[model samples]
Target chain A: MKKILNNPSDFVDESLRGIVLAHSDMLRSVGDPRVIVRSDAPVRGKVAIATGGGYGHLPVFLGYVGQGLADGACVGNVFSSPSADAMLTVTKSIDGGAGVLYLYGNYFGDKMNFDLAAEMARDEGIQVETVRVTDDVASAPAEQMSKRRGVAGVFFVYKIAGACAESGASLEEVKRLAEEVVINVRTMGIGFSPCTIPASGKPTFEIADNEVEIGIGIHGEPGISRQETAPAKELVSQLLAHLTADLDLVPGDEVSILVNGTGSTPLEELYVAYKEAHSWLSQKGIKIFKPFVGEYATSLEMAGFSISVLKLDETMKALLQAPVNTPFIKQL
Target chain B: MKKILNNPSDFVDESLRGIVLAHSDMLRSVGDPRVIVRSDAPVRGKVAIATGGGYGHLPVFLGYVGQGLADGACVGNVFSSPSADAMLTVTKSIDGGAGVLYLYGNYFGDKMNFDLAAEMARDEGIQVETVRVTDDVASAPAEQMSKRRGVAGVFFVYKIAGACAESGASLEEVKRLAEEVVINVRTMGIGFSPCTIPASGKPTFEIADNEVEIGIGIHGEPGISRQETAPAKELVSQLLAHLTADLDLVPGDEVSILVNGTGSTPLEELYVAYKEAHSWLSQKGIKIFKPFVGEYATSLEMAGFSISVLKLDETMKALLQAPVNTPFIKQL
Candidate 1:
């Protein structure tokens, strides 16, 4: 496979260094711990927000670190969770007088490592709270909401919780808000083709030319089913059906919708999906307050789309509309 | 030729509709105008900011509309400028009580349409000012800065000027700051493979398997030259050499850098380019602040990257650091 690099193994480190160099005024790297934090971090009396996940998903872990999002982010190898040691290091760096909150996805490796890191931080006298985002309804049975996998809906939790943390909310309040967001959110995805893993220099999965996968996870995990190609409107129907069934979304329910394009799905197709989705939601009498389309989060080069719905209330709406500045998400 | 689209003609319109539907709380469409404006527009006496460009560069034109960035955006067809009528409608809808400012890249079609719209706005008793972002050093001779094409550097102009507008700067002040940013910024790009336009179902340009095109423009415009594949460091050196020489950048100068990936470049490769770029800039004693590496602005599925540098001053630095809440850019 053709790539622009000196060595594949050096990809993540070099990229992190470049991010630091680019945003030196706003971010810094801890040498021993391999954590990326805001240059003016450890805001005294403010609850610290920390998130870590695999590399590859730019602006998610790294780009989301700034004034109103994450205070620090521990990055792991591509699609792999950071080690407990790494998370602990980041936790220590951003821990001020106020406690630190660990907010991340519900991926198994991340759960394992972050759990260990939280314990380590507790031993070090730093109060820590954990909020796992399990917004992907496709990943688990409707009866077990906690078993759902996390997808891009984690961004909403980060935004709301991060805004609360920046507003000097206590760790308890921030954690409560984050958990509330997780419970009210649901996502479902479809994949058209597989992406290439840089290290392997091969496609992550085999997808035939005339087929698409429904209910695929972001990390290239096996999808729920493979089906023949269909029109954009039909695809939207299938995705929305899965998400609405899982959430049991009723008429007149207010929601914040996000139609995310997995890397290779052009804005053209994404918009087509969005058109149908908006109509469907409207037909159901659902009021979508804040709808985010385009690629807020993505799996590299995967041609597909995902739909996420966050049930919104007045408090959540205000928080969602709060002004924030991060490398990736900014809402004024 | 693989795509998830049902019809080609409906692509741009459908996408715009989706954006409006998704972000209805934040944005609304002007009746049949091909413009998307913030919901709480005509903000009393605030100066309105408007920008326009072709579609396909998701989050560039549409994503930058919100509270503190752009008041409205006029979208064109894929890689094509919006009609003059569209621009005029956008200008009218976003013209706050104070006035309206026109900001856009220096593409021929966009310039023509915006210029016409500015005249129309003036005739309608609206005070209008214009700033054309010309930062692609590859598009013109070093002695003719005004002749350079506008590429990703337009984003910097959007940022600094947007902050100024948010702070209640006069139209003249906003235009002045935007012009200064344009004058100080420079960008150079390279494409390894051509992007396939969805409607055409063909590559925008031809590149041999082992070939790369240097000095590529954002719209698949022909590059300065095509050359054999080179290492990341060498490729970066060649692009930077051209940009810095054109700008006459001196040592000890500080600049905000962006290593932007065209749609299809893997993060791994982007980091490789960023590594060499950071080292080169540092070796020149240039202080890099807020280095951004990602698909901030893109060119469909083109396998390429662009480097944008904005020479910074205290004002520019503050503006860069200012909080922005747009779909694509969120700098706190």
Candidate 2:
């Protein structure tokens, strides 16, 4: 129940206010304060990529909006989907002359809201396309992959799609490229601690001190099972096993691994996990390309990390290396 | 301890191994494995900035070694100073024809070890200068500022000194610039929870569930006092009061604020604090330049944050804006 916030109801608005105030040069707010866009948004002839979801998972939902990233982001409350109105506002503000593309994680509430917003935007003579990131391999069986939830693997979607869109690609091209990334991405995570939502002032879920939840969802969703804690080497191997198998990865495969901290995990710990992952992949003869080891997505102060792998091609590798200047991430 | 690590003794070494593995293009380990240097170290005549301290605080000690930052760093165990031999190795590997500047926080163990290393390097015919960072306003009184512990304010030291040295400044000149930053910087922190060291599966410190410690140190050292958890506004106000007064900040002064998370504090919470600090400074007519609000330094998984204010001048402002490309940071 401990948090460094003032009024619970004002958490999202105040945080956004602070974000705009601090990063005024790179980002701005539209008529609806909940809709944030890059300062130079609506780049003429460039397909705009819009993303959004609940707050808390920073550098994810809103933190990715900037030059070389998403053109705009719709802000939502903690662990809650943004309103369709907010998404529509974002679509209207950042849609360059070309078209707008909706790129976000696959969650029922977010999908429903973005779909409604897309329908409304199309009614107003605007072209829109949707590409939901469903990369969490642990969320569903391979046959029911569509039911999987999006996780940190969404970083690849943003990197590839944002670069492709920035290249003046049409909406169809951008959507297809993003879909290709989603098809190649896979992620699995574990949770050791839970975070409390300000409004509720209650831990999202309870976990035993000596146990860890494998394949845990970002929102504290039930995973495969709770088991006694194990070394990072073992946990990383378990996650990568699910990821590599789901991707049908084999020797001679090339991939980009993102050792993402869910929240409270230390950066040093992520590197430790990365070391294990690198060793694991090396043993399997999988060449890692441009590995990202940090927090790309989070669940408030949840204490855990996830391992995400993005199978890469020459085109994806080239785009992934493109310069990106977001407030939270700088791949320059 | 609930850490994502293998053998506790191998934490620091394994993390550094992973770091070098991932950032091979930007950094490399000298003969001593514990001593890491920029991939392009000994930049002909550029003065090298050598920095190091204990582990755990990512982006602080070793994370600063890259282009436009520290030229080398010596690794140490968690919350423990590194050996003098490692520092000597770093100094020997990175010292160019100009000289070497040994810059690190003002801690008893670090000061002792670096002093010994500087002596050895001097005996080896390498020019050496030292400037210990003392920026934690909460650690000591203004009159005894030399005894204060360095905290996240070290970021300014690395930035200004690294930029100055990068410009081919002499060792003495870099030391002077770093000393100037130390004089202008002031920081204070608060903690809500404690983190356990992997070596000893016990909490570093403890407080009542609903209480918070003000003026807390990165090592879980005793702070001012514990009190009921207050909103970030009141807490930030309390921190800035000490920071501004210690610096004798005038209404027209310009400064850069670093809202630093000790470890587990969420980025959203840091921004909320930044909002309050920005408003507070604005009301006093003090202009903020280059505000950094994130995890510049951390204390394992302790849930707390610190506010560091650096009174800036034209020279420092220009230098601070210079491009920096480190493994943990990129200001390009």
- How well does each candidate superpose onto the true structure, as a TM-score? 0.88, 0.99
Error of 1 at B298 (Å): 2.1
| Residue-level lDDT tens digits of model 2 in A1-332 | 56778998998888888889989998999988789999998899999999999999998888899777899998789999999999999999998879999999999999999999999999998899999999988789989988999999999999999999988888999999999999999999999999888889889999889999999999999899899999989998999998999999999999999999988999989999999999999999999988988889999899999999999999999999898888797564
Quote the TM-score that chain A achieves in each candidate: 0.96, 0.99
Local error of candidate 1 at A293, Å? 2.9
Clashing pairs in 2: none
Q: Pairing residues by index, what is the TM-score of model 2?
A: 0.99
- TM-score for the second chain in candidate 2? 0.98
How much lDDT does each candidate structure score? 0.81, 0.90
Tell me the lDDT of model 2 at A97.
Answer: 77
| Local accuracy of candidate 1 as per-residue lDDT tens digits, A1-332 | 55677666776787777667656777899874348998888889999999988887765787778887889999888788999999898888898879999999888899999999999999999999999999887788878877878888888888889888888899999999999999888888888878776677788788888888888888877768888878777888888887777777899889988888777676656777888888888888888887776666777677788888898889899888776655555444
lDDT, residue B255, candidate 1: 90
Q: How is the predicted docking of candidate 1 categorized under the CAPRI scheme?
A: acceptable
Instruction: In model 1, state the lDDT of residue A115.
Output: 95
